[model samples]
Target: MAPGPIRVAETPLVSYLLRRADDALVLGHRLSEWAGRAPTMEEDMALANMGLDLLGQARMLYAHAGEVEGRGRDEDAFAYWRDERGYRNLLLVEQPNGDFAVTIVRQFLYAAYAEPYWRAMMASGDATLAAVGAKAEKEMAYHVRHCAEWVVRLGDGTAESRARAAAALTELWPFTGELFEVDGTDRTLIAAGIAVDPQTLREPWQRTVIQVLAEATLEAPPAGFMRRGGRSGRHSEHLGHLLAEMQHLQRSNPGAAW
Candidate 1:
């Protein structure tokens, strides 16, 4: 018999973990959208592989969260049964993949932060989280390298590609600020040695971004107004559309599996 739904408490720790999982899941879906639409066959496969990596990370994180919550909620439950407001992914990730340049810039910016964030999490007090960090850090390192190479290529290519890359940078730069926004949830877990301090990651993240942009011959846009609220269950309209598409199969046919 199938198990009934489990009532899970949204504790600070669970929220923190879900935020991470949601980030991976949403971004993975975005990458998956490029499956057959990429500029070349090699890139098409590469994006698919990267998407799979993020999905794998999300599964691990969601499983760990279910365990910590002491609930029967598995990865599938947390992934498919949640409403838009129930998600806690960063706004940057949930944004629509505008163009090839946009997708590359978005991935590069995110992987830049994710690489260091996962590396720092390797020292987490929680054993499961530490193990997750070890695996994810390596994947994120590769993501950073792949996306950075694309960013440079796009930025330094022909006039149209350069313009597109520059436009992508301008559009995506404002969303990067939310990556390092620390809050009460972060503070509580940081004290417990269960979370990496987002503030501490900012310097390393910026250094990587600057170096990569320099190589691409693209200038980093000056910081101005930044978006927020994804951690608090608030997201742009894009998330709702994404959730509708992503959750359709599972929502329409509950418990149906291959």
Candidate 2:
């Protein structure tokens, strides 16, 4: 095992996988909270399926992250053992879903951000990274479809639904910025040809999201400084509560496993 030459760190790949896993895990957990609370049976199925897709994405990304970072942990360990400080998830994913509109808006925005990130990452020199992106692209596309459909339906349906959707967008649109800001670690990846420029992903993400909203008869939230700071782990207050719930068993019974 010690026969290889010196290996440079692939921090971008490692960081990318960690970010992706955390996003999926947090959002998937949010969606799962609505398992039986959706307004209708069909909506329950839709949300549940989205949750499954995100959870599946989380597992793959977390497993890859553990491999690349040599963390000696699997997806479950990473997910269940982390305290709030150790989690790298975005704040938006942990927001409580107050209504169907909030859920739709949140999912749509995340899918909008994820789709392009995955599409561009499909070319990573790392075959495992590229393959993971290739597999996730399809699922992410479906997530966009389902959320976009809900966007249109809710936006164009009834006055109440339209207002609700619009309100949801107003609150959720700001969090979209987290997916685009490239930091020091991100710059390394960009220089190494292993990661996309997060700055560049913004325009396409906006165009596609706007087109979907336009078709849905909804307008963009007014331009302004959107909420930020999720990438550096300065999460909103909800993260503590979420981690407390998610990590309780792990903290209570160290190394307990099924």
Candidate 3:
């Protein structure tokens, strides 16, 4: 039987879905910032399209979460009404999309996390989540491949490109810990079968990261103290700046429907 949208009953399921969706929303917003700023026209289109895909996925997940919450909130309501402190997205996604190298590194790192997370989630006890996870798996598969190829190409391409990509990867590496950190809510979901423990994907994700870096001729940065706290709604200063730009028009013209 073809899977359908996720249907969740527990609040943890609602919270977890929102967390994943919000993660995508924030990252997609970052990519959208590159619409015309990318190094080349083709890359610009590619980034924009990728942003669109992320946005679409975010909307779908957010809508499903809203239904689970049973609070009559829609996707826009959930997105616009929540404060930054209320958002559960990780700090990694909120990092600014600086250069092409930086963008590729961020995408490569996040895509690795997204792949295994959703793949395991395809079997979520919640029916809708399973379906959403299954479909998202296909889309995210391409994102991983595209980002991986760029990482390899740039890392092995030229002196300048290699340095830049390597630097980007190093800067982005530490934030990755947040992806597989299972907090309290996750414990609840794990017991209930509504969510997969983030730790479960740790090994596979590491293998993916390691293999891709090897192919890219990139060295893994040494383990260092990671800066955490995003899942707690405590974000880096960058999130507020990003929200201001993203919500500028909406806040300025309240309820102004296009």
lDDT of 1 by residue, 34-144 (tens): 999999999999999999999999999999999989867889999888888889999999999999999999999999999999999999998988998999999999999
Please rank every candidate by lDDT, starting with the best. Answer: 1, 3, 2
**lDDT against the true structure, each candidate:** 0.92, 0.81, 0.84
Please tell me which predicted candidate would have the highest TM-score against the true structure.
1
lDDT score of residue 22 within candidate 1:
98
Q: List the residue pairs that clash in candidate 2.
A: none
Candidate 3 achieves a global lDDT of 0.84
**lDDT of predicted model 2:** 0.81
Q: Which residue ranges in model 2 land beyond 4 Å of their true spot?
A: 1-12
- For lDDT, the strongest prediction is 1
Write down the RMSD of candidate 3 (Cα, Å): 5.7
Record all residue pairs in model 3 with backbone atoms less than 3 Å apart, i.e. clashing: 5-128, 6-128, 6-129, 7-128
What tens-digit string does per-residue lDDT give for candidate 2 at 41-135? 99899899989988988998888877877846667767876556566777789787878899989999989888887888899766776887897
lDDT (Cα, 0-100) at 127 in candidate 1:
91
Q: Provide TM-scores for the models.
A: 0.97, 0.91, 0.93
